[model samples]
Target: MAVHLSEPDRLLPVPGVRLCAVAAGIRYKDRNDLVLMELAPGSECAAVFTRNAFCAAPVHVARDHLAREAPRYLLINAGNANAGTGQPGMHAALACCAAVAEVGHTRPERVLPFSTGVIGEPLPVERITDVLPAAIQGLNPQGWMAAMRAIMTTDTVGKGISEQVALSGGTVTLTGIAKGSGMVHPDMATMLAYVASDARVESGLLQAMLGRCADQSFNVITVDGDTSTNDACVLAATGASGVAVESTEDRDAFEAALLRVCRYLAQAIVRDGEGATKFVTVRVTGARDAREARVVGMTVAQSPLVKTALFASDPNWGRILAAVGRAGLPELDVDAVTIHLGDVRIVVDGGRAPEYTEQAGQRVMDQAEIMMTIDLGGRGHDQAEVYTCDFSYDYVRINAEYRS
Candidate 1:
């Protein structure tokens, strides 16, 4: 079950974006497994892909296409990752892109392809190509929800958000969708996500804004400590609103709204993590730098012992303490460190607090959401937070029988 997460009641559409989904028998037969998103002419796009050395073939194709021209369409399909197939996989991805380009009346370089699902399998190129004409004909501005659902694999609930930010000239709309349950970790970006806005922003500025937003959002989340081979996040600005984000105030407002949308989607992924019962937040403060804080937080968040303890509703402070100690911070002072579970201080001066009790800790652990704070006792003023989930019996079962 998803932890305090639900499908979006409504998704406001961006004016210059049109989307639709078609039933492509690529992997799933009964539902739409392919989605197409069309951007208005002259739209600017920024994307960040998985950094894994063995990334999916679509990742390579998408990167090359985005570099060559302004994207006109984004083709996405679920249930086949198209990774590890080497040259054959690349050929298949290109073939699908070419088909979309031919049908959409655009150059092949104007189409970016993205895929996610079981790795090491050939993408059913014909299955996706056969639906290209249907997908294009069905494109509508209000197809955000359908597009969100079509890109899902193991995700139990659809994740999406819409926000309208008022600028000096006018208001701009931002809508985003994401999909992932497990194999989520920060490597440039965690999962498959797409955010679109009608505001006017250049590609260079949009890329910089996305990088910052991603650092504070997707780059701070982890699930099972595994990054997907097909992880990709895209931010598109259609310039349909005619409100330029050139002024300093306008730029700040746009980026802030973008960050909020990104953060919400990132947390939703953790809340809907596979078999997750608790949404856990690990905050590391007082570190030498922001990077150090994030490293320490992820160390604790990815610890199996700590995650299992969370699943069992066990307040195992020692497990958290051990993970932090091994985080390899330079010249760390154990005696100066402090830790807390919610508002209950569990560790003081690097040991169990005198006022702490098992009952108080258990009370916090029993909740569906938890916050763990570790104060590194450093003089520097840097902090970072990582979002994760507890590991349960179903997590193992889901992955063990995933292929079956």
Candidate 2:
């Protein structure tokens, strides 16, 4: 269970968006496994996808459709990720888009496809297209919550947020939903997410903002340190509110809001990580550059020994220090390093703190949430924070028998 997350009571509806979810029996039974979203005519979108070279077929098709034109429809399914299926998978994804265009009265290129779940399996195009009519016929503005639930594969809770901000001329509302539990070392983004706003935005500017928001949010989180083959984060601006967010001030506010929502969703993924029992935040400060800081933070966050120690509530500071030392920082000053567990200092001047005691560290580790801070003393001002979850026995059991 997630440490501190609950299903949202309500989701603020965004103008120019209609959504619906239905079960097509693709993989799951008696539950929704498919979702369809319709966007307004003037909607503009920006997207960031996984860096995995073996990404799913829908990722390729979605990139192509976005490049050709703004998408009018988003067709997503969970249960069977159309990845590792080679050319046949590409054909299956294209067929699904063509079916959506035929039903929605739009060009095939105006549809973007997304998928998540088990890889190396062929997508059941027939099952998905069979329910397109019902999904389209039942479109409603209040379907965000249902869509959030429908996208789940292993997620323990529905993840979503809604916010309204006053822009230059009017109030613009933003709503977003995400689904992820494992394979969540986001390279460019998370498993699957869609954020839409009713404000008008320039296409190029929206794309740039997405990259910046992702760097501070999704890209910094890890669950099992395994990047999935079907990770995507998309942002859409449907211009139905008549609020033009083009000025510097407006852009900053919008970008900040976007970052907040993305960060919330990213951390929720960690909290609900496969069999996760503890949520951990790893912070690396005083680095020479952002790249090195992230390297150090991620090294600690992804360390199996460190995660295991966290699960066991063990104050094993040595594992963290060893991970930091192996981060490949060529100019790292061992003498200037310091480590802290929450507010309790564990390491000082490259050795155990003279005033530190094991009991103090253990107390911090016993909490449901843990914070580990690593200070690279006397370095340039660069820091990074990475969110992760403790490794537990259920994590192994879940993955080992996943296909069964």
Candidate 3:
């Protein structure tokens, strides 16, 4: 039910990466639900995971494995989020890694596991292990799109992107895939994002760059204001193109390319949010600091009244004003606040604009895409933007029967 999104036209694969997807029949019947990705040896990896106190077992294992060594394989399964199972869940996830390592002929410490879908249910380990050989046998260098689809749980469309740019040494390729819809909010990362590049980047630099990129991209989007227990974003550098990013210019180019892929994937998640009909962007400017600006934007974006008003095209600017006022800004001056809905200034100097009319506001809200800006009129260059989707009736319906 996304407003303006469809299956990607094409998703080119990155060098030094091979992937395959299979129907493990873990929870879904006759559908591809498991994905396995193999990375070239010596590829550097960096990742950020959810801050949820009750994170899944795979997240725990993946964190530990990533710390121990460079990962060789990424194993993901949909339809059963191995969460809330305590010690048994951890063991089950480890078993999955063992199976993947045994079949791929690699050390178990080098395999990372990920899971999504229904929570609190035991993972069907045997079903997943039984199909490991088939998945490995079907590995293809051009399996990016298939893997994208296989990781989807509530996502309506598979999301992916591929881009190339000429750096100092040569042309580097960046390819990324993401899956998310519902239970999305920014803490560390929004949902599952895996982006790989064909450039040589040192381990420390890769980790720092991925963290900064994620803060600007995945960490700024929200849907339903619910942070999932399995959110993660990973970046891998294969060093396959022989393009070692060693200079400031090369780093800038590589960072720009990575940002493009991350932004595309992050926005796609909002566009395809559960039962979403309209995409909304909230911009806050003139704040004292970036954190405050983001707090204001997210507060407005997460307001249920604001989202429902957007869905109905009601042009109820009061809900937006109320949310901003309650953003916990201790130094905010009400007299200096201004609000705009897609250039239609609704509030001026903390009150309704004299030139504003109901018809004008209604026209702006009727569009499928909207931009709402809040200016605090402070003497600072700080600003932030948060992407979200309008809440709709079908959102309730989807969750009401999610497991049925």
Candidate 4:
């Protein structure tokens, strides 16, 4: 399959990181379904995952392992979700981690496992274990697109991004690949993302920066408001560039480059959301913090009523108002809220703008991309942005036959 290549402005490999993929055939009848990435032993890693109460076995396992001081590898499969399978599900994940550990010559606890596609099924770790030796043998650094296609299930396209960071002595590279187009929400999405960088960063610093980057990147998208069982994003620093990142200046530069790659991939995921024809950006300003602003924006952006109206170009701002009311924030003034659809004014003072016309609003909504801005004219001042798309018939059509 021909994958969508990332634009030149975003095309670059992670410095010092070599990657390769082999067809483990864990669930699919053919094609590669497993990905193994080996990192330098002292590399630092940071991750964020789904908050789903029934998070998959791997999500649970990876969360605990991320607390470790360092990591050496990541193993991901795109077939069985390995979710809601109870205790044995975890055992299966551990076994797979152990297998990869053996191959990487690292402890099982140093490897992280991630799974996506389908729910409530036992993960056949043996399928991955059986072919892991081949994956290990096939490991290289150039097959970025190949690794991307190997991790897709319902996704129709592959998502990847890269960026470069200039260090005092040398340049560092960052690259990431993601697979997710449905069952997206946050506290985390159903997505599985692997990012690698050549800059040597401390574990604590990487974790701190990842948390901040995720708030603005991966956490900024939603497809169905359904968090997945195996959502995760990891950055494995290879120290290949020989840039010793010790001070805050180096950390800041590394985090910025990492965020650049992750943010682009996150947008790509939204653009490729299941059945999405229009990509929308919801920008909420004058809130109280990123948390409140994003909450309000996601509530509005993810509303089926609002999204369907957008799909049909209906220009229904009332749905936006309804969503803001239920966003579970501190006291909000209905009289102080104003919303704009692109450049078209829709709501003013929390009510329909006197100059509002459905025609103008609809015209703006019909565009392939639209922006919704919410302003709170009070001391509640903050901002956040979320990416979403209009819900369409194709979305239902694609997901309905997903597992059939």
Most lDDT-accurate candidate: 1
**lDDT string, candidate 2, 1-404, tens digits:** 77677888988889999999999998999999999999999999999999899989999999999999999999999999999999999999999999999999999999999999889999999999999999999999999999999999988899999998887787899999999988889684338989999999999999999999988888999988889888999999999999999889999999988888888888888888889999999999999998889999999999999999999999999999999999999878898999999999999888899989999999999999988999999688999999999999999988897751
Q: Clashing residue pairs in candidate 2, if any?
A: none
lDDT (0-100) at residue 142 of candidate 2? 93
Answer with 1 or 2, whichever has the higher lDDT.
1
lDDT of 4 at 17: 56
lDDT of 4 by residue, 251-284 (tens): 7787778788778888878788888888889999
When sorted by lDDT, best at the front, the candidate numbers are 1, 2, 3, 4
Total clashing residue pairs per candidate?
0, 0, 0, 4
lDDT of 1 at 101: 90
Name every residue pair that clashes in candidate 3.
Answer: none
lDDT for model 3, please: 0.91
Cα lDDT tens digits, model 3, 242-320, are 8998899999989988989998999999999888999999999999889989999999998999999999999999999
Candidate 1: give the clashing pairs.
Answer: none
Measured with C-alpha atoms, the lDDT of residue 311 in candidate 3 is 92
**Residue 172 error, candidate 2, Å:** 0.8
Candidates in order have lDDT scores of 0.93, 0.92, 0.91, 0.81
Candidate 2: Cα lDDT at 321: 90
lDDT value, residue 186 of candidate 2: 60
